[model samples]
Target chain A: MKFNLKKMLTTFILFFCSIAFLLPFVWMLSTSMKIEADVFKFPIEWIPSRWNFVSNYQEVWFGDHPFYLYYWNSIKVAVITTLLSVVVSALAAYGFSKVKFRASAWLFLIVLATYMVPPQASLVPQFILYRYIGLFDSHLGLILLGSFSVLGTFMLRQFFMGIHNDFIDAAKIDGAGHWRIFWKISLPIVKPAVATYAILRFIWTWNDYQNPLIFLRTDALYTIQLAMQKFTTINGSFYTLIMAAAVSAILPLLIVFILGQKHVIDGIALGGVKG
Target chain B: MPSNPSIETKTNIRKKQKNASKRRETIAGFLFVTPMLIGVSVIVLFPIVATFILAFADWKFVQSIDNLKWVGFQNFQGLWEDEKFIKSVINNAVFMLTVPTTMIISLVLAILIDKYTYFKSYFKVAFFMPYISSVVAIAVVWQVLFHPSQGPINQVLMSFGIENPPTWISDPNFALLSVMIIHIWISIGFNLIVYIAGLQSIPKELYEAADMDGANAWHKFSNITFPVISPTSFFLLITGIIATFKVFDLIAVLTQGGPLNSTTMLVWHLYDMAFLNLEIGYASAIAVVLFLIVFTITILQWISQKKWVNY
Candidate 1:
């Protein structure tokens, strides 16, 4: 095949743009591993001259603040939220799509309408309600608030709707109940969609800053994002340690994205097209 | 007589069983969504109604419930006269300029990457990395990078013989711009993935047909590719507007609406009003205004889609 000049030029341009996009992350890792003295070196090192990985990470993880505690809190909240959200959304999606109940269409519309309501609109009132209900500064509050995602239900319902009615009819004839059919037959078929939603929900919860920032006050119950802010505020001059903390905060989700790149990308595309 | 009686009894039993099963199914359906309904009521629906009501009240954090003053339209009137609220609205509009910049860059990257069969996923992942990471973490990295004295960005600028580079994230003139730059960078990856999918979905036959008609690259792109991907573009545009309008995390982390409050967008302003100043009623007014803006834009987008979007 003949090489096309225009194609080559565009490829080179994209290659450079990709580097520019990835440069901050590269710099993040480089800074995270650098000693304080080497961090401000004029040459802007891509690789640290002196590897301070162990000490930097140690300080971030085991320093004056409870970084490890925050990490665990974040993990607990994210995991619980993801699981509850997936299950609730899946059930709701199944009910909306498969069950021939009265008022189902209206109920589904209500769910869809709620998707358009920005969380910030309800934030202050929610804060008051949480405080009144004794859920203030608690991980449970965050989990409960995040557990029911209208977007997840809407997306999954689309997938659930695509499953042929014949499957449900056959299950009904076989003396199967709605729950059995949902758990045993239809859900299995839509496993990929469910998994995609689950991964997206997990990442979203893990990266969430606003909810934890506003809801949780106590430092011990702080999520990693909240703790990072506290750490930065207290040790603002310790650039090396802050970068190390930043890396620790983001590394898990980055690993998740790497492992499930297809799901994350496809889920985003699905959301875009469907919307 | 005996055969008829037995048949009637059998039919009655079958009917009763069927009715019982129908009841069970209905109960199961309700049970399935019970948790979500409770969550929506307590967390989403009730709070929304309360926010609407609270917007008109004169409730302060220090005041008791019985001491609350019901001042209809007063909070909203206050918001109208508030300079900070006006500044935030303008800042939000200025910040929205990132949407188009992000879209153009994402579209160009998508097209370029779509042309190449090699390392496509690599480029896509690289662009998407920032989006997947935490905003606080990303913002911190940017803060370090944009440091006025020691940050590599200013260092590079000085090396290129551009003297006296502005203090990004610290200077009022450049802080909002700095935040916008980061926003654009973070959003490009997600938009690129979406656009690539849209580009891929455009039928190959259209391009082949255009080639047969002796259409040039620009002609084919304008007549075929652009129209076909209009829906995706429209989706991105609407969501981007809504998301950027409510931008809080980046500002909260990086600038905290500092350097003369130049970067204070709608949500950040609301946050400061409610959480910092303990002005719940006033903040609710801001929230209501924000909701109205987002809701209106969304409805407008839906109504206008038929005019431009192909599908």
Candidate 2:
């Protein structure tokens, strides 16, 4: 454990670099709280000149647009999607891991293959289908679109397969059904994986811009990402206000990651791609 | 022999336990999985097959299913002659070099952070924070940061006696580069995490052995570190490249294929044709071309894995 000066110097610089990486976000947060006059203050104030920060949020919440509509839409879509995706993935993962069937592998491959198709590739067809089904511009429709993902199913299957057979066999011997075994024995053990998948799906669905952009025509149905996209105009730009909106949109994701970090870290650690 | 009392009691109990639970498992499994299965079939699965077939058909609104006419290779011909489409393909090639270079450097940064013991998660969180945020939000912020005049970046440069920083978003020469910078910045977290994970997988014993052999940090890295992470790097390379090729949202939010269509990547081109111009047949063709390009490159990388992606 000799003290290597080169290593120390590099690490020292990297620490500040990492901080510098965070500087834009810091600046955004500070600027949002600053008075409109101090928005471009020289010497770069890292904190606000003003103590109170309400008018901006006040406008967002109660403006003619009422961004809370966007907020509510985002929450509804994200929650429904996360729950649907997780349950479906968990069930499918358990099936693939435990069930016997002639065409299971083929079916699973088809599922994974769906991930390879770029969403852009399916844009027209999905639009046609949603339009036909009368699900267009509806919240339930948006939820269903975001919820189904093959990647989640594929990722969860690996975790379920890692669960040992002894517990499953014991459950069976005790007359526990597949549902009970899946719920009690399998689900609890693979909770880390389930939690990780949930966080990812939630973040992705929340941050999704493309789907909402295309499917959501009505102003009432806009997600936060879509709202933030339409914030900028060619003339009379509101850079500070948009930055404020941006920060608000990202805050929830930060919260989710903070709460789920341990489970996520364990999940990544289990994958062991680094080794 | 025992068909009376003993057989009757045993038969009843066995039927209840076996059939009851097994029957419940079959029905419950299907019920639990139905939502995803139905969603995937309609939204995801059927779309793939439908889009491919629709690629050959000539339709404007694509509303009347009966009005679709089979126009084999006609749409592809139009896209080939499209000057805008041609420019998009060329732009994609230029973008390819810029994003990957940034990915490599950030990976090095991630590895450095991994080696240092202090502030690991803090650094991880810092590097990864940008990733979880909204792409549209980040793009909008960067749009201001790279503003032509009255922007901090140029202002700081002028303070250092440098002058005339290009208008990043508006300048044709810098527009694609500006997008590339954002792409790289946004991507660093995921790539860093992947690289850091790859780095951690390398055993300490190899470094210990290298130490006994009088090997320095560079020596150990070239031999021990590089080979071990090749698989993860390979994974990132294919996935990142594919992701870059298919990039859309940020470009849509930031430039909209600015000043003179200099920033018109293929996805934007395809999107414009269909939605803006209402040319479904031609747009479908462009999408198919994009798919071919991505699929071919992915397969090439997959093939090269035997040689370069050592695992």
Best by lDDT: 1
Off by over 4 Å in 1: A4-9, B1-22
Model 2 alpha-carbon miss at residue A89, Å: 0.9
lDDT of 1 by residue, B1-311 (tens): 78998999899999999887777767887887777777777788888888999998888777788878889999999987988889999998998899999999999888888876357898889899989999999999999999998789999999999899999999999999999999999999899999999999988998999999999989988998888898999999989999998788999999888889898888999999999999989999999999899889989997898887787
The runs of at least 3 residues in candidate 2 whose Cα sits more than 4 Å from the true structure, single-residue gaps closed, are A1-9, A50-52, A265-275, B1-35, B62-67
Quote the chain B TM-score of every prediction: 0.93, 0.86
Ten contiguous residues minimizing lDDT sum, candidate 2 chain A: A266-275
**Over the stretch A47-69, how does candidate 1's per-residue lDDT look in tens digits?**
88899999999988997985889
* Chain A TM-score values, per prediction: 0.96, 0.91
TM-score of each: 0.96, 0.91
DockQ class, candidate 2: acceptable
Rate residue A265 of model 2 by lDDT. 54
A72-174 in candidate 2: lDDT tens per residue?
9899899998998898888888877766444557667777767777778778778778888898888777888877778788788887888788878888889
lDDT of 1 at B191: 98
Clashes of each: 0, 3
TM-score of 2: 0.91
